[model samples]
Structure formats: structure tokens, C-alpha cells
Target: MEELAINGGPRIRLKELPSRRDIGSEEMKELVDVIWSGNLNRVGGTKVSAFEKEFAMLYGVKHGVASTSGTASIHVALGAINPEPCSEIITGPISDIGSIVPILWQNCIPVFADVDPETYGLDPEDVERKITDRTVAVIAIHLFGQCCDMDPLLKICREHGLYLIEDASQAHLAEYKGRLAGTMGDLGCFSLQQSKQMTCGDGGITITSNDELAERARLFADKAWPRGQAGDRGYLFLAMNYRMTELQGAVALAQLRKVQDIVARRRRVGDTLTKLLSEVEGVNPPKILPGVKHSYWLYPLTIDTGIIKATPEEFARAVSAEGIPASTGYIKRPLYMFSILKDQATYGSSHCPFDCPRYNRRIQYKEGDCPNAEKVLRELITIPVNEFYTDEDVNDIFRAISKVARYYRENPKA
Candidate 1:
């Protein structure tokens, strides 16, 4: 393995993200025109209503309610369910904190569950074990664009009479067993943040098959406004202002129109990278479970730490030095382990809605609460796989990663 010049230079700077305007200019302009008209609320607005209708049709859901963010969507869904305070919501701890934040915000407790080693999604077995009479819901996150094993998860939720909410923030347009990710659960929330496959700068949509749940979500998101009522009339119930703006809805509508092409390009790049990197020693492509159509939000590779001489950080730095964007580390740890959860002063000891003192204290994560999650966090490396990558760019990335892996294998530090 030949060592190239290892100067500190990023192959791709963060600022170089593909422009949303370039991808969906027409829709953006329409959104701007609507914004200029000064009608942004959900009531009696064409852009907002049109976006919701189109989005609902796309997802095959009966209703689609837009929210300020994915977190707010989750909060609205949970509020609509109206789970008892302190009731538990089972979810993976390895996902983005946003997935679990709504649980805490809803005055409910988040019960951490382990993720599958390969899929990096919630493990049904772990979720089953974590359920109790107080468990009111299960928020299944489709991590990194891959859908979880939903068949078993759905069964578990049904058996326990728990509300099933799909956190489809990353798995936009992904599928499992011939069913779309967002449509499989009782309520599904999607993110249109800057990083997601589709973006309206920042926004989210909640979809549901039940009209009652949808109406409840709409009310919770709009400060309990009566259905079909446009003007504010002193409000009807306690709720938060989580409505999406006209501009955001417009941008999102435009982005939605081109989602298929964007997803296809990402898959193409992912396929090329996976094929090229699979041959390199100590580098493993992200596993695709059967029946899953992944969106490739982030292309991840797991390193065999025993064979690789350099640490994940060293490998990432080496690749970045060669002008290929690379990163290491799992997104974040289980939410329970965070200092905010550990420090009672933040939310107060009584802040935890549940009464399981033993479960609350002992259930807190230890160093190896999830052995596979910890292992993946320590050994995984990720490279950008976006629609903007050209054939040459993909090739360059492959070469850089291969060179880095070969260098680590050949050079052993005593």
C-alpha cells in the first residue's frame, strides 16, 4: 500500500451540498409567490392544502398534516394518541435524539431498545421485552434509509394494543415487504430537513390512515383549532403551534415531484460504491435486509477492527486528506445515557412520568447496554452518497477508501 500525501484537506466541504433551488426551482418559485400573497396558515390555503393532499396521495394515507419539524410531528402524533403521562414508548436508543425527544416532550417515558446489528433498526425482540402494561406506543425508526423488520414489530404492537408510530425521517420512500415505510404504521412522520433526501429547508409531515388520528394531529399542531375553521377563535384545546409555512409547503411540494429521480440517483451511487468497496479488505458495505428498498440516505461501511491497524477516526482523516468526505462514529448513543436524562435537575426526578423507580434507575444504560451498537459506533465509517456524485466522483471515493483500507492492513503499529 502506497501512502499518499496526508495533508489536512476536505474532499468535499459541507457547504457544497446540492442546491434545492436547482433541483426544484419551479415549485420554489410558486411557494415564494404564495408567501408573497401573505397566506401561510393551514386553513383555507391552497399551497398548504394542495401539498398535504398530494403528499397523502403519494403515501396512500388518508390524511397528511404538515408540521414545523419532524420532532413536532412526533409530538403531535403522540399528543393525538393522548397516552397517559409517564407511559412508556419503546424505541431504539441508537437513532437521532429527535426520534425520542417527542416522547419526553409528551410527558411520557422513553424505553430504550436495542437495534439489529445489520439493519441498525429497532430489534423487535428487544422491543417485546421492554413492553409492559404502561407501554402505550412503539416508535419504530427506519434508520439510515433502511426499513426495520416491521412484520414482527407490527405484530407486537397489535398484540399489546400499543399505538405504532413510524419515524420515517430517514427512510423517505423506502419499502419493506412490498409496503411503503410511512404507510405501514398507524401514524408516520417524515423530515424534510436540509439533509434528508427531499427538503423544504426544514419541515415535516405526519400521515395516518385513521381520520380521527389525523384530525387529532391537526388540532394538536394548530393549537386545537376546530376543523375547517380558518380564523382564530380563542382556541379549543391545549396545543402548540407546529404548523408549516406556505413557503416551506411549496418547496416541499416541488421536491416531492422529483423524489423518484433523486432516490434513483442515490441508489445508483450506492450500488457503485458498494460493488467497488466490497472487494477491499476490512471494509463491509452496509447490509440490505431482504424485502427492503433502501433510499441510501448515508452510505455506511463497517471496518473489521481486528484487521484494520488504524482507528475509525484515523481512517476517516486519511480518506478526507485524500479529498473524499468520510466520517466515523455512530450518530449518537441511546437517549437515556445522555446527561440530560441522567441529571434529574434538567427535567427533575419527578419529570419521568412513570413510577417504575427500579426500572428508571436500573434501566439506565451501562457502558455496554447494547454491545453491537457500541461496536458499530467504534468501527463504522461513512461516506457521502448523494444525488450529486458523478461517475468520476464515485470512482474517486472508491479509490480513496480502498487505499486507506489497504494502508491500514499493510501497516501494523506495534
Candidate 2:
């Protein structure tokens, strides 16, 4: 057929790929209410508490604790559970720094576990192997809005008496086998970073049904003070201040109301693009396991380099040349390979956490530790499937991918 777009063929001439974080009159109205209330911090504000209650109820949980950022949410979760200092918390190797920073913050060891190649999630078997006498918790991250297979993970937790937490930072309103994400675990945390489908610039929440954990999370998020209470505040637990502002809460509440529609649009467009790309040789769409409902945060396409004769970076360049925005890899490498963990460089060279004698094991972060994650990252190409993208935008992405794929297959170069 047609000539490849990378070879002087027509490109998707649009100035922008898609406009996301859609704010409107409704959002402004909510902000105005917060502004007039004159309460900036949630410690004495109404919006934060209202949003937390609504969000927790939506996930079928009894309580929610709003925090300053996603990392703060995790830190609060860890603090609430009080996982032993210098103990181990096993987590998937592939994720944002937020996933591991909390583990380090708690003076705990961050045990690296390989991910399931198909879902790019925590592999239960590897997780089981990583557990030890010091293993106190499991942080299962539902990366890119796709839930991890939770049954096995739950089983592992129950068998070991370890706490299981869900890092649903990228997975709002995502369901796994009819049950909503973050509900199956002991506690679930979500990020409201601007780039996420639901955002308030920067904020986070921790949800749990356990009354004790809920109480602790609330206290921890607000510097161990009894929030929603007046007079003679007592510091219950050793904690830090990570409170969300009224402004963030107002906008986040508005965004939360639109999450269902936003998630649906992303899934629809992502599925449609996958449907078209599936027929194209050398292109493999993201894998949605049986009974899994994926809320597409970022659409990942794995290219079979053997057939395409091109690396993920090269293929992404070709596609981008055609005006479709795509990136070769999500992160530079697995979390462990980074300097913070590799050389035990945390805590300003003291390595207090990793160096703690209670953490007796000599941790190392060499290559080949997480082979699956490493391989998947290399072959992965990420495309934004934001809610703002329409069918036309999806079609354009499809054509760009197809053009580059076929061209690379035939030419084996460029």
C-alpha cells in the first residue's frame, strides 16, 4: 500500500494530540466555594473531609484519609500499619519513586520483586519468594490503571500475616473481576497528580475499612493530631504533617464526580486503538487478563523487535515523526537500579534504613535482578489515551503506528 508517514507521507497534522485535565465552569464553581470559605488547610477546612468521605464510600471502604501527595499517602499508610522499622516491604520493581520512597521513609528495607510480564504487575510467586521473617507488608501497585491479579496476592498475605496495600495512584475507578481496585487489600492509596485522569494539581488519599487503620491514617496525615476535633489537640503517634488543602479537595471532589465518564472514554479509545493495531504485524497491544477491566491511564504497545527489525526507541521515533505522541519506555530503569537503592545512598549517605542492623541483609541492585521488567520496559511503547481524545485522534494514532510498524517490517531499518 500506502507510503509510510516517516518516508514523506502525510502526517497527523494536528497541533495537539489531545487536551486533557478538562476544567470547566463546574470546577471553577467548586473553587469559588473553597475560596469564599477562607479555610486553606484541611485541618480546619470542610472540602477535604467531604472529599475523603465521598472517595472512601465510593470504593466501598469505611474511611479515607486525605494527604498532601501520593508519596505522603504511602508514608501515612506505612506509618499507620507501623510495619517494623528495618523490616521488609516487598513491591514491584517497576513503578514511580513514590512506590519505594515510603518504604525507605519507614526505616524499612525495600525488597524488589519481579513483575508479571503480561500485566506489568507484581508477580505473586516472586513476591512469596521475597518474603521473610522481616517481611511485614506488600505494596501492590496497579500500574497504568490496570489491576494486579489480587487473588494470589491476597492468599500470600493471609498465609504470611503480612499487610497488603494497594498503590492505586494510576488506577482510579479501575475494576478487577467486577470488584473495584483498592478494596481487596487492607489499605489502598491513590494519587491526584495533575497528569492522572482525576487530579487536583497534587494530592492523595488513603482508604481502608479497618477502623483502627483508618484512625491511624487520619492521625498520621495530620501530624498525629486528632483531625475533625477542636481544642487540646494531642499528638498520638510520631508522624509528620501531610495535609491536603481546601483548594485541592474542592477540585479533586469535582474531578472525582467525573471519573467514571473519564475512565470510560479512556478505555473505549484505548480498546478501539488496540482493535485496529492488533491486525498489524509486529505490534502487540496491552494484555487485559480474563475478567479484568482496565481503566487506561497510559496505553502500552509491545513491539516484537524480531519481526519489526527495530528497537522500541527507533519505532517510537518513527511514530512520533508521523505526529503521534509515543514514548519508548515509561521509566529509565527498574526502581532498584537507581542510585537511591543501588549504592544504599538513602538518608544522606548514612543509609540509616538499609544500614540498620535489624535489616541484616546486604541489599544489592544489580542487573538481571528483574529480568521480566527489564525486558518489558525495553519493548514497551507508551501512547497517551487520555479522556479528551476522540475517535479521530484514536484513528490517527492507529494509522501512525501501522505505518511505522509495516515500514520497519519491510525495510528492517529506519
Minimum summed lDDT over a 10-residue window in model 1 is located at: 13-22
Q: What is the per-residue lDDT of model 1 for residues 1-414, given as tens digits with 9 covering 90 to 100? A: 365436433343232434333355677587777877888765656777788899899888899989888888788889789886678888877777788788877777787778888778888998999898778999999988888899999999999999999999988888898898889989999988888888887899999999899889988988886765577675777788898988788888888888878888888888888899889889888888898888988888887778888888888888877777788876745566676564422455554534445335333545567677767777778876678877877888888888778878887541
Off by over 4 Å in 1: 7-24, 229-234, 348-363
Best by TM-score: 2
Local distance difference test scores for all models: 0.80, 0.87
Q: Can you write out model 2's per-residue Cα lDDT over 76-150, one digit (the tens) per residue?
A: 899889987888899988889998998888888999889989789899999999998989999999998899999
Pairs in clash, predicted candidate 1? 11-323, 86-353
